[model samples]
Target chain A: MENVRVIARMDIKGPNLVKGIHLEGLRVLGKPEDFARYYYENGADELFYQDVVASLYERNSLHDIVSRTAKDSFIPLTVGGGIRSIDDIREVLRAGADKVCINTAAIRNPEFIRDAANKFGSSTIVVAIEAIRQPDGKYMAFVDNGREHTGVEVISWARRVEELGAGEIVITSVDREGTGKGYDIALTRSIARAVGVPVIAHGGPGKKEHFTDVLLEGKADAIAVASMIHYDLIAQQQSDMENRSEGNVSFLKSGRSSFGEIAPAGLIAIKQYLKESNIPCRN
Target chain B: MSGKKIAIIDYKLGNLFSVRQACVYLGYDAVVTSEKDEVMKADFAILPGVGAFGDAMNNLEKLDLISPIKDYIRAGRPFMGVCLGLQLLFTESDEFGSHKGLNLIEGTVKKFPPKKTNDEVLKVPQIEWNNIWERADRRWESTPLGSCRSGDYMYFVHSFFVQPQSPDVVLSVTTYGETTYCSSVLQGNLFACQFHPEKSGHHGVGIYKNWLTNYSNNK
Candidate 1:
């Protein structure tokens, strides 16, 4: 199977990166730059820097933050929030963001998706759809940091966004946000099946297993997370294992090399013995 | 003389940066404009869209660009249409009660048929890296369009597809379930692709290169 891309989401409020339930009143975590570096160093494929409060603040200060983080990190960065016009899109791209995500603006205008995609190319324009599953078994799109309900169907919007030349769609489920009860796999699979573009599943995901589930079952191209990595549950375990191991350790245990050893003398002896006997040993 | 200027038609619809970035990557001067004079003056023109075919057509009409665009294409200048751009070239689309398109090509755009089993849904918009088949005789087999070999995955994201009246115009074909849809079409100097070359990554870049170096250079 192809390696699934992992994206770390840093939903920022003011200067601090935060994560919370849905979009109402976020819980501050750490500095955006620090979290960005952490994710980049620890095998994250990309980083999403969303200024969650930009709509409320009525300005895009996230560009400065994204610029700072982009300068420091090597991985791809996507910046979203308060991106209302072509100029705003240009500002974020010029600020070193690899891609610019538009949620509320794209939903409000719909045409902005195509305009941005045409100007920047679809690959650089990401449309973030913050959706929630209605009680009537329909997924509806939300805007204004998932505060305002658009009443537009999520699956239809996914198709529309892709048609508008959005290179990717980032679907975040409000009901599943920060719940750590695994992703809304049904919602993700539906969205993934709906559009031709890559779908980045956001919200839920409490553990690495959740990531695997979304990638394998949900068939998501990319998984975006906040609470899982932010709290250091996943990273801490991997770090602990690394710290406990000595030099040149291998995790594979099935006839493979064991951890905390450069090489077992028995394996070396077997290699030498095979060489002396003119027997080929695959290295 | 050294650099080429590519104008992407801006109809106040989709974002135009993706194409501009692609042009920049190819080391060309690319601009997005809806102005007739600017478009007519460009060395190459790219019409890209992502919305209802009727809405895009309406915008093009409102901008008073229909004649200018037809003139540019008729002048034998290089032009390429992407996704909705490709759909717009068709005669009409079944989206939102049958809307007339730009009618540059003889074709119709229609949605994928519904899935058979209620439990097993057929994936619409056909989003993923699907393989595109090139025509035999090594015609487009050697061009930028050739980059998408059989089984070579190109990104796709759309429900509707172009059904060209003439087989000669069908440049490439991609399979989705039981249907082998038109992945791209080439008619004279005009080229259109259902798949997004900009989002297709290195393969997409190769396509742009071929368009610039081969197709665009020939003119």
Candidate 2:
């Protein structure tokens, strides 16, 4: 078994870091670089920056943000959003991302995944699958942050992406995203079982147990968190506002944690819980 | 970490930025360049990249860095290789149909078997933080891994691993799904690893610092 990775995922919308429930109703958080620096300092295994509104605009604006974050953070940074062609991927990578995750372009042309894997290495390519569980007991893939539904089955898509040369797959549940309900175990397990590549469970994770549950029960190799960790940062930012020197952290002072019941915990606390639960994690 | 002309060889592959960042963080002024003269003139050189072996070899050849890199190592100055850079030092690779490498180390880079001994399908590219343990005969006190504990975890993302012809040169090994392979090697001034020291967090950065310090002391 692989050591479980705790990745801090930041959903970016233009200049501010945003979050939403079920991938809708965007709410501003703060500057992504600020959160990125905090996460790296707190022991995040990896960092993911997703441009929430990039696909609609056909241009990724996270280049400046990614470059700024890369200047300080030493961990692997994955940038995803509006990536259409080889040039787009190259530009994002040259800016500082170690890996580029694609969804909209990959769904439009599946061969783009293959082309990317061949041009770069398979390890540099990650395919993000946005899935919504249907009433028929099936999961359907979605694009553009679950706004557009592609009729493609999530399980088959996961297998195809792996076969197409995706080194890793991040399966985000559109229904559970930002809801704090926990990860879709059935959805993540099915995808993890269907593919030979490492699968990262994303979307809902309200508590530390949710992480362990996804890794053990869902069979996920890693877990990507946005609301869970972001809320923790918000709490920290609020208490330390007096010492702050730069950036508008008023958004973080909102004291808004949509993740109900379970309190927000830092990366170290989460890793400590995983370690106590006998799940290997890099602290 | 002071005034050491560290050349981070750039062949249009991998994340040279993070490697340079890690070096700079350690207070060493490193340059990312493809020029042979710059690389040769550097006190220490690091070959770091992530991509196909064939393409990397082609790129190195195109940029005329193959000889300079080999000459730098031959001159006995400190040298390091990361990920594909480590693979490139081997004799050849089975990735994308058997491509010849720099042949500095006598080894063949081969992919992990599809199935483990338990008959379970093993995931390729093993993208995770796996623990690396020093060999029983090897003492890490003198190597770049001097600061690393025996079971310290390191970031890894690769499908293929190196099988050095001489086991004595193997410094560490990591087991993934029952497939144990050489993870790092130390042969005189040449040290390389399959894991990325730059992206491996604090412990990873510590390895670079140790390597630089070791080079400085020896000089």
Give the Å error, residue A32, model 2.
1.5
Candidate 1 TM-score, true structure as reference = 0.63
Clash pairs detected, candidate 2: none
Candidate 2, position A104, lDDT: 88
Model 1 chain A lDDT-worst window of ten = A257-266
Among all candidates shown, the one with the greatest DockQ: 2
Looking at model 1 chain B, report the run of 10 residues with the lowest lDDT sum: B116-125
Provide the TM-score, chain A, model 1: 0.81
| Reference contacts preserved by each model | 0.04, 0.68
- Candidate 2 local lDDT, B86-185, one digit each (tens): 9999999999798999999998999988788777667787888888998788989878999999989899998899999999889899988888899999
Candidate 1 falls in which docking quality class? incorrect
Tens-place lDDT per residue, model 1, A1-283, is 3223457788888888886776775766668888787666555556889888887667988766776665545445788888899998888876777688889988889998888876766667889988888889989999887788998999999999888888788999888887777789999999988876678999876655666677668878777867756655324434565788754434322213211111212222322433354432211
